[model samples]
Target: MTGISKLLMTLGVIIFVVGFLMQFISLGKLPGDILVKKGNTTFYFPIVTSILISIILSAIFYFIGRFR
Candidate 1:
């Protein structure tokens, strides 16, 4: 297959695996994530989760690039 097609397929598989694992892993509620409650207001942010995903994706792409 073409390079773009292979890359897209690889990403799709990665997303599928992550989504499947999320059923048993609670990354959204990680300790460093932020949750705020003020009277009648509430806010939630998944900073840690975002960072973790970013790191993981960076590493994955780094290796993928190295191999290619």
Candidate 2:
């Protein structure tokens, strides 16, 4: 059981890393509006923002698992 758990964790980490790599190569930004007013920026669709966040979270998980 312990070995199985470790294998599953390793597989999860691999998937997360591959996903993170894919997110970095996306073309163009998310499908949303880029608004700049009063020197402030806001996104409407937020696709790019979401992708970045996902990548960060996945990387964090991957490293945490490896270190553990």
Candidate 3:
């Protein structure tokens, strides 16, 4: 398969794994994440979770690139 196809497949599998884990883990609700509530209004942002995922993915891709 081509590079784009390989990337998409990797992304799909990552998403699937994350979704499956969400059933047992509370990822987005961690401390340092943002959640706003007002009269009849609500907002949410998983800042910490995003940072954690970015770090993990960065490490993963860094190793992959080093090997390749």
Return the top candidate by TM-score.
Answer: 1
Local distance difference test, each candidate: 0.90, 0.70, 0.84
Give candidate 3's whole-model lDDT. 0.84
TM-score: the better of candidates 1 and 2: 1
RMSD of model 3, in Å? Answer: 2.8
Tens-digit per-residue lDDT, 1-68, candidate 1: 69999899888998898889889987888999999999999999999999998998899889888877
Order of quality (lDDT)? 1, 3, 2
Worst 10 residues of 2 by lDDT: 27-36
Report model 1's TM-score to 2 decimal places.
0.80
Error of 2 at 60 (Å): 0.4
TM-score winner between 2 and 3, please give it: 3
Q: Candidate 1: which stretches are off by over 4 Å?
A: none
What are the runs in model 2 whose C-alpha is more than 4 Å off? 1-43
Q: How much is 38 displaced in model 3, in angstroms?
A: 0.6
**lDDT value for model 2:** 0.70
Q: Against the correct fold, how does model 2 do in TM-score?
A: 0.38
